[model samples]
Every structure is written in C-alpha cells, then in structure tokens.
Target: MSNFVTLLVEDDALQREVLADVLKDEGFEVLECTTGEAAELIIASTGTELQALITDHNLAGKMSGTELAHFARDRHPHLNIVIMSGTTVKPMPVGTAFLQKPFSPERLLDMVRE
Candidate 1:
C-alpha cells in the first residue's frame, strides 16, 4: 500500500522542494507549504487522509512549527508530526517526532517511513 498523504512545511525553498520530491518518490502524496500558518490552514481544511506533518521548528511566520503541530494535534489526534530543528526542544506533545537539521534525505525518509 502507498504511504499516507503528508504535508511538508519548510521556510527554505530548496529544502522544501527536495523533501517533497523525496517523499513523492517514496510513494507518499505530498503537499508543500512555506509557513506554519499555511500549514495550519491545510490541516484544518484537509479533513482527513492527511496522515503526517513534517515541519521546520523555526518558521518564518509568528507560528512556530511546534505551535502548528499542537494546533493540528488538537484537531487530528492521530496525525503523525515531525519537527526538525538545530536547537534543543523541551516539552513536545506525546507521539510527536523530532529530527535535527542537516540530516540526509535517506534519514528523513527513514523517519517518515517508520
């Protein structure tokens, strides 16, 4: 079976494109966004079938990735969330995943595929 649909939120254009392409190649239907606010909109309107969210912790907008993830989790309790950042994190919600920056595409895929 195909992997579930995923929303990828990253402020960096190149990183967003690369991750989207990699996820697509791995049989995941991918949606891309540039900001946490945009990602929240997608999560709200998506109305199911979106299984995962991969967000950069340091987003361009006022909403950080953790904020977006929390907002999403409230509505979609089962949605898998992955937050990527170079800085240390504290008190993330249960079941959310974290990845440090500069990870390879393969490493990213491994996390998502899990």
Candidate 2:
C-alpha cells in the first residue's frame, strides 16, 4: 500500500464518495470535504503531509477550487493539484492539473500519481 495522502474536495456527495472510494481502494489515504473553506483548513493544518488535492472548480463556499488551489500552492509548493469541472476552466493556477467531470477513476489515479 502507498502512503500517499490526498485531499478530495467536492460538494456533491455522490461524486465525493465515488472518488474517495477509488482512491482508498488503491491504497491512498483520502481526506474528503464538502467546501473550499473546509479544504483550506485541512491544507493549512496538514501542511506538506498532503501529497495531492482534487477539487471541483465550482465549490459551495466563497473560495472556489481554483482559489483553494492557489492558496495550497502558496503554502505547499510541491503539492499536486487537480481541479475538476464539467465546463471549461480558463487560466488554471500554475503547476496544477485539470480533470474534466465524468472522467474515469484510472485517469484520476494517473493525475494523482503523476
């Protein structure tokens, strides 16, 4: 089993559960949250212990996933970030990845493990 720790932020419960299950099945430790605010707190508290962050661009809070990604990048320069959205997202933060909605678990795994 891998020791990689990943943070997954998605407001949709079903989507969150599915992705979390997939990641956990693959031996990755997954932290899940429903809003950008919560995710920010986790990021701040966890520091570099978090290896990856996968979040939806349009989140439930004032801070969007893109904003969270930028915040995370500022703190954890080497953290892997994946922003997910059905619509096109322009100008994603530097050094972050984008995963479109309806993507396969394998694709997500690839991005996380990349």
- List lDDT for all candidates, in order: 0.89, 0.94
lDDT of 1 by residue, 1-114 (tens): 274899999999998998899989889999899999999888999867988899999999999999998998998998889999999767787788999888998989888867
Q: Count the backbone clashes (under 3 Å) in each candidate.
A: 0, 0
lDDT of 2 at 52: 96
* Per-prediction TM-score: 0.93, 0.96
| Regions more than 4 Å wrong, model 1 | 1-3
Q: Write the per-residue lDDT of candidate 2 for residues 1-114, one digit (tens) a residue.
A: 477899999999999999999999999999999999999999999866799999999999799999999999998999999999998888899999999988999999999998
TM-score of 1: 0.93
